[model samples]
Target: MSGAAAAAPVRRLAVIGCGLMGGSFARALRARGLLQQAVGVARSAEARARAVALGVVDEATDDPAAAARGADVVLLAVPVAATEATLRALAPALADDALLMDVGSTKADVVAAARAALDAARLARFVPAHPIAGKEKAGVEHACAELYRGAQVIVTPLPETAADAQRRAQALWEAVGARVRTMTPQAHDAALAAVSHLPHLLAFAAVHALAQQPDGARFLELAGPGFRDFTRIAASDPDVWRDILHANAAEVRAQAAAFRAALDAFEAALAEPARLRLLIDEASRVRRAWAPAGAPPSP
Candidate 1:
């Protein structure tokens, strides 16, 4: 989207932690003929084998550094908690001119980690990106080349980030059919915390609360489409969510507190029939109007 000329297709793409996000990225890039070779890294041998078998990568390994050795682009797709350690491991093996980016949910902590782990020269090539796309599913087995198509990808570049690196990152996402947007890391984190993280936390809490009731199993048997839709995210990988929630704790907490206040207001309105109806109507109205213009629900 920038006026700059397009860079050459990536010769070797190294993906660290090749799960749903990373595997989907490799699949998408390959589908567009933008990637020549893909190397995937995962902590588990079974995962590595699965990635290779699924054609997500040409080769797989447990060492991030090894996978990154000759890469033209390195995509960090590990959990938020594992990002720093992975970056530190790859730092010494990274090529001087290789582009670096990530798909982490939170950006501030990742930017901080890059600052601490990478030298100034290498840091310049690192761009922080978060793709606003995924399913409740996890694992490379569930990856799809079209996952990022028509999705929004947010690139949060630091003040010191190199212009070329930022441009390349945006271009790559665009080539993969993602709409790119740029913002500061702080703003990105705050916005995601409110829209993404808080809703996930609420879903997890709701499911947990329901499971604790004496008639929990019976209640679950009677759950309808509304319950299934609302709690869909509660089934997301807990380890991944744990890292994201912890990394963005402050903003998540603030959003959670705000949500609690709203819930309390609803509870207080229970004694007033008219007020309760008004509250429900207000919430329904807001939700109905919140969908992006021209965006349709996924089939």
Candidate 2:
């Protein structure tokens, strides 16, 4: 209410967590005139204050239930580990017909948690989602309204999820400039484990391994652009990554094994000078012929 302007319509949106992803969603809603009023919920008083001060939400509270009490759309944006607890806290407050969605990186775990926490009627309105775009940075200060632009957003709905709820969730993401896609919770987890989770793990491992060297600090200081780009995700929130890794352990492990195999093959090629030259030439040709100028080749 404090941040509401004279003519601004209020859509009564509630965002749990108010971190980078949550704050960005709220900001996007307001920027596009999609929400009449937005409220933010976070555990810390400082975060609540920051959200309100930044105008990401008209009101902010530390109580999840209080924020979700009458929200038309509730977005759970907490870390994967905390998502279940947050959903549990808000379950009683969520309206039976209100749309409930999440931006958690993993889908299956969140879907299971929502099933366990919400009542049958409330569960029907839940739509589990993951926005496939983010920065290595964390916190509300890093959130931007345009963060979701041109990004893929996967919406995973169980059989119990209402068709209307799923449609609304997809519409909301599309409204925010995202390309909404549908998948089962299992498929979503498996795909993300390969493209997203595994890459993060590799990046983290690479950085950690490099840091263990005697000249690690000096090496990092002298690192080039390729190293910087490859390792950028290593700076992502540790707690969040830890939860994602554990949530999709099986798929992540499989992807990791595949990556290890590829690395071994590369190493073998390096041991043979002729093969090494062939490898470089083949890689260069394929990369030049197929790769997009600024984007990775789509799978």
Candidate 3:
């Protein structure tokens, strides 16, 4: 929704989490020669080592602040729950002109974290971003340079965000081969709750419901492609999803209420043949007409 002039290569890039999202970003930018140096920080020494060993980043460290120090750009790619603590650690070390952004799944909570953790100047440098791209499998080992190619990235700039930071945020994502869409933090959370968060919740719940059955194992043995496709996201990292679901709990709850109402309508329609056909037809039309951004339409 917003546009910025192209940014030249940066001096340094620092990533706080150095996991799937963070490592992938580093790889993407490195492929483009966008930074003179790229550093990564993570709690797991093994992961940090893997990042450097895989050349996802030029260097690695355990201290987030140490990695952030002197960096021209910083990406907080940790879990949404760890956002505040990570920001607190990095803020003191962040250079005044440096731009900071996050790859968080949710924006409202991350914006709240930024407000609580950073001073006015530091907050001004912070840009909240969510790249709508990932694989079901997550880890530094799975990081790829092409992961964000053609994906849509949501940029939610706060009122306090500096013009330079916003511009850089837009440029950074575009450089990584992602299309950018700007949204207010509240709007981002509300809309994502209905489309993304609610679907993940349903996938997780459906799998749990299936596994809880006495014939769960037997049922699984006979499962087909439809079951596999529907529950694929249930295989997502539990801890990561837990943090996301909790961080956006209020929005997710509101969306869930709407989902229940939809379910109620479906149930009522099931009792009437004509109404059932109408409901199915409407849903089919909507689904067939829609496709993920950058995706080819269904045949």
lDDT, candidates in the order shown = 0.90, 0.85, 0.88
- Candidate 3 per-residue lDDT over residues 104-172, each given as its tens digit: 899999999999999998899998999988878888999988788778899999999999889888888
Candidate 1: which pairs clash? none
* Candidate 1, 1-299: lDDT as tens digits: 22113645789999998999999999988887788999999889999999999999999999999999999899999998888889999999999989999999999999999998999889999999999999899999998887887778999987778998888888888777778889999999999999999999999999999999999999999999999999999999998999999999999999999999999999999999999999999999999888752223656
What residue pairs clash in candidate 3, if any at all? none
Q: Write the per-residue lDDT of candidate 2 for residues 1-299, one digit (tens) a residue.
A: 11223223337999998899999998887787878889998878898888889888888999989999989899999888887788889888988888998999999899888877888999999999999878899988888998776678889999999998887787778777777788998999999998889999999999999999999999889899899788989999988999999999999999999989877878998879998888678878976886422222342
> What ranges in model 2 sit over 4 Å off?
1-10, 278-299
TM-score of every model versus the real structure: 0.96, 0.91, 0.95
* lDDT: worst 10-residue window of model 2: 1-10
In lDDT terms, which candidate is top? 1
Of the pair 1 and 2, which is ahead by TM-score? 1
Superposition error at 14 for model 3 (Å): 0.6
Give residue 215's lDDT in candidate 3 (0 to 100).
97
In candidate 1, position 279 carries an lDDT of: 96
